[model samples]
Target: MNPKARSYDYTKKTDVVHSEILLPKNLSEQLDESDIELDFQRIADLVEIGETTKRGKMKSSARLAREWVLCGVPELTRAENIELFEQFAQQQSEEQGVLSMVFVHDPTAGDDMATTKAAAEGKSMAAPDPRNIHAHILLLTRKLDVSSDSLLSLGEKSDSELSNDERTRPVVPKKLVGTIDPETGKKIQQGRGLCSNSEWLKNTRKQWADILNERLEQKGIQPVTHKSYKDLGLTFKPTKHLGKNASIAERMGVQTEIGKYNESVNRYNHNQLEQTANSGITSSQQQIARSQRWIDAISTGDAYIQRQIEQETQQEKHVNSRIGQGVRRRAERQRPNPYEQQLKTSADNRKQRATELRERTIIFDRASERADRNARYRKPRINGVIGEVDRLTMKTALLFSSRRNESSSYTDRQKDILEQFANENSLVTGDFREDIRVTTTFFSDADNAQTHKHIVKLINDPEREEQNHSKTSKFEAESDLNKSTRDYVDNESKTSNTADLSVSIAPRRYRRP
Candidate 1:
């Protein structure tokens, strides 16, 4: 058979028998060495029969005692050491309700040292069978009162500040101002303050509870309260548990009931300690969990923040680049040009003005020619030149001709017409008429009246006309018509006087009259 698969059963008559103890090397070495002698028989005597000798048991009674000695031993007798260890176990049970039997069985004599130290530190070390180590441990396992002084005093205790100079510190009672009697000048200890209205009374409850808690802490008692100081200050209902007699607590025996209430309160607080211990996680586990959550949250938040910052930076860079490009383009296009727009406008206006001036000058020249042609300063004239025959000569010539007798004998009307024409022609014999007629005929082609007047003034000088028209024949032709008019009148008078006497003498030869 293989050594790893060996099995041995030891029993007798259907009752389980004790198996041979197999100690580890260190325990065997201590058992064998004379100098490290241990009282295994004595340890067996201390244990209950079933605890040490039962078969199929995981640990034996003697092994338990031997394990304790193998670890570092404390400066205590075997029995005293066991009692100290038991106290630790009891303390653990009272504080944490789930009793840890494994902690009690921990194979370390250093744990015994801790128990002995706890005794010195004013913690209970009372265990069963004070002379025997195993019996004392067994009695502790059954039940024991564990002193909590060491645990309660784990942290630094608050100490009242002491006056360096020996003057007494004033002790003031916390009460409303109106609670002080005006006449007696003392606090009205019997009743509530006059100013203890609803608001003040609400706050007074918390003030009272704080005073109570503070006073209790002075006497080494911790107060356990569900309501926070802020809640208590607002509203506190002690009467729900105390009833209406709460107002007259002393006379109604409610004071005694209140004292019992405080006692129960202390026990309840102790119970709460155990409850809280059971519910709380170990310090190491709590710290690890809290740190992990915080790290996860912070890492996620930091990554988001970093991404946002990077995005903003990228956008800013893009915007800046665009702005820079725009500025560069503007700079490239920049130039100084003379404003041709205004110059073009001015040139256009000047050209238009020149065109208008030319048109105006043409109009003015036309108007000047028209004014010269129609000049108002020229004088009128009448004359007996070839183009302007003497009006009287023409008229006389027409009358003396035989055609005048055939048409009609000269009536008075015809004679008047002939005379009127002679008068108007200025042929009624003015000194100026012959010169005017000569000058008028000379200036007939002068287009304007003013030009006619100038030429007439120059040429109509009597001496100039005589010099200009020196031929006498031009004057004789014009004078013939006037001489004929005088002859015809004389002939007409002789014929009328000779009548019939001269008829036979032959009608005198009729010449062209």
Candidate 2:
């Protein structure tokens, strides 16, 4: 036998003779033994109930232990604990002589009861001893009672309701242990446990904040504020309210309160600028109205604004043009026509007659001046006189009115040409020189030749449309030639620059490795 396995004397030499062996002082000279065996299987039944029960479930170790103790009580049926006790006995037997110490046996077999009863009644048995059995039972019972009492004192709870002790209920642990973020001090949610990754948590909070902020903005609220986690009972150092970047829900809560204040302020100031624009009474008022129109027009979206601006600009231009036309007509009626030498009846009639008379006088003056200047140097010719008369008449018509047209019948507009010529020639040097005063000049020979050529061309052109077409074609050809010349010059300059750039970069290839 191993020396370490040697048995020791359980009853040692006493200090006071072991205090008389602590013998029973009861009737029949027998010690009173606890009849309860405190089987762990019965205790395990209570544990199972605590683990799976819909109500009063065990959450703490103390609660779990109390539940086990309650299951092992005599109130539970012994038949339900047969297998539990057998397993317990099997495990205990494996321990060095522990089964013999407790005298464990299946209660259904009714064998260990007799031996246990005999030993309790002061008889010998194949087990350790009746006293040892009693001690084990007492120890197990004490442990159960302690755990149950502790749980009761701590006010174990399973629901929202509080226990008699008034202690706060503990939250159920989804995980055993988890790391919390130092910054947030909130339990980080992890896939492995209850906490998550710090970055993920932050992102989630940010997303939530964004959503909340959007909702608040939709309701016309702004400027959100929320306390930091530290202020809200977290383990991290305290921080100020999340003034600009709080989660949406928290921000929204604050925004709702501020929105009322903003609404009142807006209402009070509503008419300050907007009202002035709507009241159209004075020049300043009209200006304000116009400004508001521009603002209102622009506030509408891009497409609407573009259309409105175009329409308003066009309308204003048209109205200004009509006013201009009216002014011009009135001024024309009031203005003195330069050719008119004769007086008229009414102011309007005088103005009209003055305009007509002015044309006739200008025509006469031009023809006479040309004829007198020519007659002094050379003999008169019919073609020359006709050219002079025609040129003078064209000048008078062009000068007097824009309404005169070369395309109309000559008879209709030729009266001014003949009458002015007759008036100029009617003043003879033989008797009357007063009518021959020259105040203006006439067209020169080159101009006259050019005008005659143009008139001849108009007369020779068979198709009216062909004449216009020829003129337009000449104009278009000239314009195209100018554009082409510009393009050719630009292209040549660009090509030269590009060639210069290519030549410049040619040396750069030598620098490569």
Candidate 3:
């Protein structure tokens, strides 16, 4: 407990704009102590006397009080902030019947370590922001016993000080089965349990956030949230809570380990924001490029049809060189076309992948919140390291499934993004090789029909130049090929044509003979 009014004396402190003590409404008149320090001192002589009217005289060394420093918006004055703390105090009083002291301090920036350090080092720099307006809430754990008419005395532990089970247990009634306690004239029934659990803490935090946001709204400022960054879908590192001593040392320009770490965290969060903004811009550009490519592909379909018609028209003429080449060997057959169906399929697949990635991200955020909502900045939080590791492994498996189902190929950009996501969350994803796999082997017989139709076009030609430019040898070679092809070519032309073979006869005869 903070004694000697050094930290608690807001009335005398220049930075303190206001100070007030809140007493339980239903307590006796004498229980209202104007001096907060006196109530704090009287706590030492307190005794946890059971339900008996006998003169209580034992002293206990239990905890006295817990102090909470309530923060406020700098723009709001002490009076505006008072309304917020009033609701907080009222809740504690009305629900738990506890005593509280509120001290609202004027703006003072204990926020900057760099500027403070520079000033301490005698650098000529502008002063840092003096806007850390906040309040001190000192809550006494012991309730004031009002049974005695003469002296103000400390009583049992406040409802907030009691454990969950202790508070939940049914209180013993003043009169049990028509039996009255002979020690006291009228019996006192035990009070209800106002002790806090995890749910209660969460509600309390939410209530505080709501109250603060309401005050901020009244001042026309932005609101704040009660949830963690992960829960809010914010991808950034969280700052650690530097205790009072570390915070004081930091503000005084004395470098603390946690202070330095917090600065790094701040820098990281800022960078994260910048990266997210840049990523958004890049994604928009990529989307526009994709749409342009789609339009171009659609127009190319018309070009493909036009090209096919030109090829058909060319087939009617009988050019010697054209006849020498097989029909399937034409350049038109080899020309590549952007298959509209394949493009559509690919687009649909990518869209599905984006949806799955988004869903998985949501699930991961929820899982992270469920795992470390309470001690987010603390190591080995709710779900310990091993549990977290296992969750991450499962997440890795899920991510692998998502990525594996993606478009057949993951580009460098996609891989980078995935790696970045995993790194940001401290996750070791499944072996990336497992992401894309060729399940069913695919073979494309792009070559057209090898029917006799191809053979009919394949004309044999002699090396006429070798025979001193003689035309008879070439003519005779062509005649032989023509005669040999006439039998099967006619039948193939009328029924299921396939090219019988390449021009092997002349080449073999020329070589063997």
Candidate 4:
């Protein structure tokens, strides 16, 4: 019985009998009542049941009893079935160290009353069935500690009255060791009570089956196994267990939903088996064809085909070996490289230096332009803007100041800035002097005040008197080249137009006359 409260109703079962107990025969004989009160009292005595304290009230809802229904084959005699159950109960008591009360129940115990009813219906009494001879065993959850010959001292008393060590001590024997509590990260202390071990109930079921099989083997009967249909390699669908209500309805010739489900499962299993059988034919043909190919390959003994196969096998082996080596080499190359790290560091440093220099150059150029516009010596403005003449004057002064300090050794930052600027303007050459010259010439001509200021700031500061030097020297070279090109083009165009005009005038006068 599960949900174990159901075991309380077993006292109402008239066919139940107590055939086994751990106590002396004198004490056992004293318990003769066949009622629920006697059954509860006996169970409480056997397990030494105690009350649990809950909300300041003493209650006892803990499991005090467990029951099992043991059935035997119809081939076994009534005495043989009883002997089998007795052995099973005794073994369970010895292993678990708990007391178990066994009872043999006969389904035909009230056959006389059943026969009288059948006669009233004009039916004869049916023969007794051997399958109805089974046993019911009620097991105690607590182990017995028999300290004295008296049965009253056999069970555990209240744990509160015991010492701390004694209360913590196990009531049942430990069957396993080294088990740990997952939540606490500590070794689990076992030996609490009977059925506390998870394997206890499972082992009990297997133990009963083993004992029953042994008895059947001794009687020269086919042994019954406890395994499921799948475990026994059977393909049939198993039926579900019918509970009390369903069992009663079935006995009264009432069909149930479980019966319909079982019928459908059986039909499905039959179809699956048929499909498997049909597929087996195709599988057999494929197997035969494979065998025939093997036989032909062996009988023909074609040297060319055999040699070709051997060569192909060797080629495949070589290819696989090469591929494996290539993979290993690639993995090695993917590892970090020290030389590449060093080169990357060097490139990063150069880029950072270039960025700083470029920023400084822009700031210096902006300041120089602002200072030139505010200078008192600047030319008077025309239409609220300074003429190009004043801009040229500032450029000439800065250029001369830079040239004066050209002999000074340049810092690494300054050198890098100039080189980068040259590279950007596509003016770099193998000669350092020529590269600098071309870079400066482009900057001066393009009105790049930023580069010009950066260069002047890198050199020594010029005096105020240097600004008054004639601007004639800076414009003389550019002015002469421009004047020569403009005079040549004007002279050629004037000569050609004069010749065309004279020819046209003569033709018009001749036509008018």
What lDDT does the true structure give each of the candidates? 0.36, 0.36, 0.52, 0.53
Give per-model TM-scores.
0.17, 0.13, 0.41, 0.38
Which digits, one per residue and each the tens of the lDDT, describe model 2 over residues 1-513? 122223455232121110101111221122123222324444445444544434454434433321111112122244323323333333323321111112222223324443455567886544322221111211111112223222201122322122322223233355623656589786644222222334433543454345445544554433132445443332233223332223222323434434555555544433322222122111222333344454444344345435645665575567556655765675667667523412222354556556655765675566556555554433334334443443333333232221133432234324354345435634222311112221112222334434443332222222343557579999999999999999999999999999999998886546666
Q: Model 3: clashing residue pairs? A: 450-498, 450-499, 451-498, 451-499, 452-498, 452-499
lDDT of 1 by residue, 1-513 (tens): 122223544221121111122223433443455343324343333233323334534333222221211111122344443344444334333422221231122222223433354467876543212222221121112111122331111111101111222113233365643387678897544222223234433443444345445544554433324355345332222322443244234333335666577657655643443333223211223333454454454445545545655665575567556655755565456534335544554575567556655765675566555544433221111111221222222222222221123333334444354345445533333333333333333333324223433222221222333444456656787689778987998888878768655676765677996
Per-candidate count of clashing residue pairs (backbone under 3 Å): 0, 13, 6, 0
- Model 3, range 1-513, lDDT digits (tens) per residue? 212213343233355666667766776245444322344334433423332234443224545566767777666765777778777876676565767777776645223444555577986444433666677777777776654445556677766676776666456765662455578755444545454466566777788898898777775554677787786456878888888567666666678999899989977775565444333422332333454454455445556555644553454243323533543353345536436544654575567556655765675566445544433443333234333323222232333334333431334444555456445534343534223111000000112111211111111111212243346678989999999899778887756433334433335545654
**Can you tell me which runs of candidate 4 are displaced by over 4 Å?**
1-18, 22-41, 44-61, 112-130, 147-202, 235-237, 262-513
Clash count in backbone of candidate 1:
0
In model 4, the clashing pairs are: none
Please give the lDDT score at residue 18 for candidate 2: 9
Ranking by TM-score: 3, 4, 1, 2
- Return the top candidate by TM-score: 3
Model 2 compared with the native: what TM-score?
0.13
- As for candidate 1, its clashing pairs are none
